[model samples]
Target: MHTRFTRALVAVICCIVLVASCARLEVFATSTSNTKYSNLDSSKWNLVWSDEFSEDSVDTNKWSFTIGGGGFGNNEQQYYTDSTENAYIENGCLVLNAIQESNGEENYTSAKLSSTSSWTYGRYEFRAKLPGGTGLWPAIWMLPKDINVYGGEWPICGEIDIMEYMGSDRDTVLGTLHYGNPWVYNTGYYDINGSFEDDFHDFVLEWLPGEFRWYVDGNLYQIQQDWYSADSSGTYSYPAPFDQEFYLMLNLAVGGFFPGDPNPADWTSTKFYIDYVRVYEYGGDLTPDSGSSSTQTPNVNLLQNSDFTTDYAGWTTWSENGAVFSVADSTLKADIYTTLPNTWSTQFYQNVDVYSSTTYRVSFRAKSSVSRPITIGVEGVNNAALFNSTFTATPEWQMYTYDFSPSVSCSGAKLLFFLGNVDGSQNVEHTVYFDAYKLVYLDRKREYIFR
Candidate 1:
């Protein structure tokens, strides 16, 4: 399944620097580059492979079709097919079309294409015009050549998302990396002032031994260097998963986990257009450059007295319908004496500063006197929903960790835990204990110079 979560509405400020050794950079308003797709100097790269889509039909030697339905792990509504109506070449461009029709048990039809070739590390580029409408989720991504490289499927094998766009949000695109056994991932977004469907834009990814960089129209936006893979045996070494070869995939999904179902009256059809795809290998000298470098400050936990060491010095508790909250022995306890009418009727929270476009990792250890579920999330002081999820707490203490970005920035955002009958099902009185709370910002502030 294409695992995805609620998106944040924060803006990221990034700078682009082109050195003398690099090729001259040109800015475009709403079209692809007139010359080569890459902004990197010609002396630094070798074009290894490319698909210009000049022919009237698809080149089967370089691409293959994945045909099936069953949601493809994302609860998607489209049934992928090899039919020419769904995927074809038109006007010197590859078109992936999603249409409303009954295909088997699915109510929609679409197409998915996978590249026949795979590579370990290189620069991958795509010039494409995205589709628009609610419920359309189009993506250009990669999967490992060997799914069992890390002893499991999906996140264990690792996935790289060069670009993913939800049709409802026409101005933003996402670049993400998925790895780790329990499915850990990091995502960064690039937004434009206008819809992507208006013109073709260059989406590029540079994959090296220890780092991955994402760029849009030659403007570098996200850089990721830390990742790992593990399984039942033990944790693999650094970069063990991404170091392997991976193949490319392109698809347009209808109503998946990332994008909700489309409205039948509003959207019956949409098309994702691809002008070309290219891959390049570094051919220049491999040496440190004096022109550019990067330094990272250590991540800091922003919560005060997170462990309840001072007995809720920075925390507050609110209860309705006879619930109670207390702190002792470095643990915060919540007792639900009666079933609450709403999930937020009882809350334990702390006000924290939250910034736009920044990702935060929230972690805590918790257990319940009786097996049950609780709601945890971050919300604005005005009760604006930022992030929230229901997690079950067992009799034994278990560590829970999640990464999220707020849709809005707030100086006093509530970091909260709701200790109420989650869905009005568990009405019996129960006590939950929480400890070792932490909230850390996964700072992405860094700079890089191509050597």
Candidate 2:
């Protein structure tokens, strides 16, 4: 997944507040454990596949080489080849080496390998040590097995980036999901306290129906559930692109759009080491305790004056490009007089308390004088995004609903709606209206099922 770095949507300002209290349901798994894996519990997961890289050479039955020098759509400087000089198994690890030797028109040569097998939903993990040098880009990613299934290629078929590391920035790693016809993507990053080149670390992606979670060294960092894919006919149903089988890819690219051109003075060569690759599937059932059955409580709206009966009591509106917000006719109104640079330039939001692992629903009725798109999501006080989705607002009023669960508890969270021009493309003035905004807590019940 290659994309240009763009401006962030949220600007976090730290604030101290009282943490909200929440009650959690206790559930237990009764299955017996058999596996000896350290990070995974045998009662919940079953190892389905793995590659330890102990063989004397690259396993041709499991991996195939992708050889080229056309930059691979990223204007990269490296020419990928299957030569052992670029890729080979050494000391029980799969080594991918990037050398400065010229191969035809390209000034550098590297290697890329794709798994022969594909999978739909599972836990994918990679343990590896990253290479560091100016202009080096190492990645462990996935692409759909059938690219033409969802209309066209590339973004339409979807891409899951399990891990991507820049040689220059050795402390940060990115996990991203690429989808949508016009090419929309969501990315999450983890900042390692130390350089990734110092040692091998575990990068994992737990992908299930409609949900994707990313972790580094067993620490959960990012989660995303809102995405879409479309073609000539129309938008496919929820989770269409991700529902298909996808194969794994490992590559070390030199220079190009992501990390820029590598500086030859920084290093003559670098090596990426992979200790293993493993996959797992859910095996056993987890249910609630027999004495305490799952039950739902009455929904309680957490927002104040949601209907704008008197004024914007608990809501706040802000803009950088002179957009004005007011309460009119029992609806929250925004009048945009000028175009903005970013989608979040003109914003409307409210602070709310959020509980970890608890589900919350946001419902609202909205419309715009001119048809356009707006983004809505929940963000932490420190600017970490919990969930977000883009929606088109037509002249006719329509109801919108979103449900999400925060992975971590936050005393201060913002539920925001962004009405500025999306992608800096639309530069016209328009008015938008929001009414009947409601944020409610949805209590989840635990139900136990015997195996």
> Which candidate achieves the best TM-score against the true structure?
2
lDDT score for candidate 2 against the true structure: 0.74
Root mean square deviation (Cα) for candidate 1: 15.9
Off by over 4 Å in 2: 3-42, 285-415, 422-438, 441-451
Model 1: lDDT to the true structure: 0.74
State residue 132's C-alpha deviation in candidate 2, in Å: 0.5
Clash list (residue pairs), candidate 1: 1-73, 9-407, 10-357
TM-score of 1: 0.58
**Per-residue lDDT over 112-191 for candidate 1, one digit per residue giving the tens place of the 0 to 100 score:** 99999999988999999998889998999998878877765666778899999989889988888878766555566788
C-alpha TM-score for every candidate: 0.58, 0.64
Model 1 residue 102 CA deviation (Å) reads 0.5
Candidate 1 lDDT score at position 213: 78
Candidate 2 has its poorest 10 consecutive residues by lDDT at 10-19
